[model samples]
Target chain A: MAPVSLVSLGKAFGSIEAVRDIDLEIADNEFVVLVGPSGCGKSTTLRMIAGLETISRGELRIGETVVNHLSPGERDIAMVFQNYALYPHMNVAQNIAFGLRHRNLSRAEIKAAVLDAARLLDIEALLDRRPKALSGGQRQRVAMGRAIVRRPKVFLFDEPLSNLDAKLRAQMRIEIKRLHQRVPTTTIFVTHDQVEAMTMADRVVVMNNGVIEQVGTPLDVYNKPATRFVAEFIGSPSMNFFDGTLEAQGEDLVFRIGNGRALPVPRARGSAYSKHFGKRLTLGLRPEALSVSDASDFTIEVETKVVEPLGVETIVYFDLAGHPASVRAAPNRAPRAGETVPLSFDMTFMHLIDPEDGSVIPY
Target chain B: MVSRGGILANVATYAAAVLIAAFFLVPLTWLVSLALRTPQEIFFGASRFIPENPTLDNFGQVLRDRGFLNYLWNALKLSGLGALGSVIVAAPAAYAFSRFDFRGRGVMMMAILAVQMVSGLVILIPLYRYMGWLGLLETHVGVIAIYIAIGLPITVWLLKTAFDGVPIVLEEAAAIDGYGHFETFLRITLPLASPGMASALILNMILNWSQFLVPFIMLSRDAQWPISVAIYNYAGSTTASTTHLLAAACLITILPAILAFLLLQRAIVSALTAGAIKG
Candidate 1:
């Protein structure tokens, strides 16, 4: 296993830059996930690391050696594609043993490796089946077996779990994590699913428009998103934003919404936001941070627009001073559509963002 | 609950299918009947669909002709070698067209397809002069070379479509698996595209087997004449007197092609439909 380093790595297709010069250093045995929406360049960065795409600028190092000019095989990287990409003509044993063809190994060694991979993937019984005969999950496991059988320097995954159903995706997610724990291979997984990123990655690198927005541990990025995009993207149901200005009302400060509703800034946060008084800003609040039972400094009555009861918790979409907002409340406490309900914004977890640049205002 | 309109549509579809089938089948049936009939029945008897006095005498006569055996060997050698050579030459070129995203790829593919539109008849005299200048006239090598050129464009196009059905990700996976370009092609891409290659080989073989103008113009020696040229010569030399033998010879010339199609129809159909069904 090797630590992968992308030093100002960039990729350009004619005039369009698919991946901007982005620098990242992944520790050996770290499971770093590059997560974003489609066209965010997550896959491009992963492919560049895998040597599938040429890096137009900067250097890439794997295990302290510059690998920018090396081929994928020479760099010793194994990748699992979004579609699994198993050879349709080969059975499971052959598929897993295919990578070993170029190596100087005896037939018994190849057979043992294949059997070991099959055992690790719990696919021992499927060693004789062709890919067409396998289920989606089985195919995914076979793809995994093909990669891990080689024991390459770095494992690259390009949205490997995207093709499975939700239930299977979750199961495979745990299996991948468990496999990593067992082998501790340095892996770079590219996916657009934030949940997968949060659950599986040691660190999540959030990207947007070919640029990395944030790179931190899952909890770090979730609890303290570096930018407004991360604040919305990392959380479920997304964080709601209010467009208004921070107004100083005599002795205290209050955030004035578009419809003239003033949410009082807590005394503890008065000094932190006092400098931005009378300037237009955006307030970011996650769905889970707004509650129906708790009372806080920014409590307001809203007209509920829609209520989605998700078994454990209910998400209520409402209008907060002319801006759309959502809050997570207990299933029994959720109000019906068109009903007026009081939601207390937990300012402790509130994020004050600068409206001009979509960056969170440092407090 | 089928509707009345649906029933009418089904009837119309069946009628159209039957008409198309008859259009092709009637000639084959007539050829077979003539081949089985006596010379008198063909020349003097009433025009009937079925032969009253059927016999294998014509087939026996055609097979007994010493020249026919030489013609059959020449035809098999040319067709088999031409088909095999065309597939071997076209595979790598088709793989490049299918997999690589180089400049002028679209233009090159269009150019190859454009070659298909020009028939051998259009350049028959020029081809003869060129073959003579190369001192390859009246030779089997010259004729097979021309057959390969004639088969290249369609063979490349068909094989390219087949190669397109293979996912590029498989190649990338192979690349990561430590296989080089030639090895990856031989082990992964080639095996996956075998159905398309099979169809291309069979199609080229059939086309070369029925090739008439090329060998007819290039070769004057009866020993080197393929089945098509020999049949044409036979028909010309004994137009009325040996009509039954001529028909029997024509049927023999086409039997291999018909048998090949019957044996490998699934491969041809699957190769053609693979790209259509693939998402």
Candidate 2:
């Protein structure tokens, strides 16, 4: 078990840069998930850490060794690729024991290690089958078994569950978390799915456009995002942004919108936006924060455009003076599509984004 | 489930196929008929298409007096070693061509193609001079060398296509599993490309066995002649007719080709998709 550190990492393919200036420290026995959309350089960063890709200009240290010049075998990292690149000619036992073939171990030791991995992954019955004969989920388990038998210093997974169906993906996500708990190896998993990051990561690193937007626990990133990109990207039915200008009237700050509505800013962090009075900024509000409150400081009247009743909560989508917005309300109190109702924001949980640069003006 | 039009079309297809099969089968039947008859029957047309008397005496004359056994051994050694040596030498070069990234890769492949595209007769005089300087004019090794050179370009291209079809991830997985590049290639990629390797070996053997020009240009000794050249010796003489010995030797030569086709036709079919459709 050892920590890995990457400092000022950058990668380029000729003139086009893929990843730029990334620095991250993964502690020993910690599970970190890199979450982003496609082309965000998340997989490239994981490959660089796994020693599969050459480091363009950076220093990468694993445990105590600077591993920029090391091969993947020298780095002691096991990677489970997205497609499960199993040797088609080898059976399950051979696939699991392949990593130990060159190890200075006896036959009995290799057999025992393979048996242990099969037991842990519950693939004992499948030890003799080929990959093409196994189901998708079984193949994934075999892939994990191959990685875990080696018990490398670091485990890297590149979207291992993306090939599974929905129910199986959820089940394997929990199994992967349990495996991490049991083995406690420093693991780095990369995926474009945010739900997997939220459910499985000890810490989540959100990336966009080849840059790290924020790195924190799932709840912290969901609650207090540090940028407009993070604020919009971290939630399902993403946050709504409305163009508004700030006005400091008397001793309070208010947001003036085009629909002749002025919202009172929460006074708990009014000083952060005090200097930006009369300046154009963007106001962000999550759908869950907007409930059906009759009397609230932040209120807007909207005619419902679409009502989605998902049993636990009903989401109502409507246009806010030509900008699309949504509200989460009790399912029993869900209004019809043609009805008009007033939605309220709790005001303290509102996100303020600077329009000049796509960063949040932290309160 | 059969429609009227579909049945008619299938009947037509079967008719066309049977006609094509008969077109190829007639010459074989005639050859067998020719080998079973005596030279007197062949010249006078006294025997029918079915011989009145079939005899092993023609095979005996071919084996005992016509040097059939020596020619068969010489041809087998030449063709077998030529094909085997070509595959062994071309595999690593093809692997390097497919997997590495360096300057002039495209140019090197194109250069190979250019050399293969050139007329073999254009280089004949120079090749003869080169062989003479090496004192390799009349040996089996010299003929084998020429056959391997003729087989190299096509064999390398075939094996390169197979190597390219294998995913690099398997090799990377092997590397992470503690095997080096040499071991990974031997244990992983080579086994996956077995069908292609088998196909290339068979194709090279066929190519080497059928070649006549290089043997004519290289070997001047009658004792070192391959079966193809020996067959010409019996048939191309001015005093000879289409003797029973030539027909017996020709029939004997077809056995090896038939055996090879029976054994390797599946390997060739599987080679078209090996390492390509699997993980």
A-chain TM-score per prediction? 0.97, 0.97
How well is each residue in A1-363 modelled by candidate 2, as lDDT tens digits?
789998999888889889988899999989999999999999999988877788898899999999999988999889999989899999999999999887899999999999999999999999999898999999999999999999899999999999999999999999999999999999999999989998999999999988899999999899988899888878888898889898877888888776868877888878888778788888998988788767775577778999989999888899986689888889898998979898887767788788888888887
Q: Which residue pairs in model 1 clash with each other?
A: none
For model 1, residues B122-225, the per-residue Cα lDDT tens digits are 99999999999999999999998998999999899889998898888999998889888899899999999888898989988988998888898989998999
DockQ of each: 0.86, 0.73
Task: Quote the lDDT for B42 in model 2.
Answer: 74
Q: What would you estimate as the lDDT of candidate 1?
A: 0.90
For candidate 2, lDDT tens digit of each residue in B145-193? 9888888887788788888878898998888887888989999999987
Best by TM-score: 1
lDDT of 1 by residue, A1-363 (tens): 999999988999999998897989999999999999999999999989888889999899999899999988899989999999999999989999999988999999999999999999999999999999999999999999999999988999999999999999999999999999998899999999999999999999999999999999999999888899999889789898998899888898878888888877777888788788889999887888788754654567778899999999989888777778888888887788888877786667777898788888766
| Interface DockQ of candidate 2 | 0.73
